[model samples]
Target: MSININSKLDSQNSFWDINLEGELDVSTADKLKEYLHGLVEQEVVDMKINLSSLEYIDSTGLGVMIGVLKKLRTNDKEIYIINPKSNVKKIFTITGLDKIFKVEG
Candidate 1:
């Protein structure tokens, strides 16, 4: 399945609220990159990524997220992951990424 990214910038916080749906895999990783990078270029640094409707995510997808986080850190910014499904949550646990990233229910 393709990934869908819906987003809106919050000027007050200099951040964005981004919603993700469908699957995040190798095929869709670029979409994530493009969307996040586009936001960053617009000076929107921090982001709250809503993954509640995301059904699946592959390793490539995870890697893209990590890359984005690392890049954001260089700018003193961050990304918060929100409302991940159980299976996707398990992937974060197994990968030990939950400890690295901010995840909110």
Candidate 2:
């Protein structure tokens, strides 16, 4: 029903370490978009998102990620998805997003 985002910035590496927990559907997608956008505005840096604890995600959540990826690409930065649950990983694969973003174990 809700999503929990825990994020930290690694200043030395100039990237974000973000962890997602709970469901990421229409209800929660906007929050993530806003958070990521705020970070993007501050600096264009790579983001590594850990999805091991994420229970679910819908199209809207995927859209938010795509949008952020697009923004980051302009600066030659990228988003790395780390440790996604099998179901979530399947969605990315089916949507052809896995090829676009770096999906690491």
Q: Output the number of the lDDT-best candidate.
A: 2
Q: If scored against the real structure, what TM-score would every candidate get?
A: 0.95, 0.97
What is the C-alpha local distance difference test score of candidate 1?
A: 0.89
Model 2, position 66: C-alpha lDDT score = 95
- Provide the lowest-lDDT 10-residue window in model 2: 36-45
Q: Write the per-residue lDDT of candidate 2 for residues 8-93, one digit (tens) a residue.
A: 89999989999999999999999999999998888789999999999898999999999999999999999999999999999999
Clashing pairs in 2: none
lDDT of 1 by residue, 1-105 (tens): 698899998888778899999999999999889888888788747989999999998899999889889988998888899999999988999999998789888
Candidate 2 segments exceeding 4 Å error: none
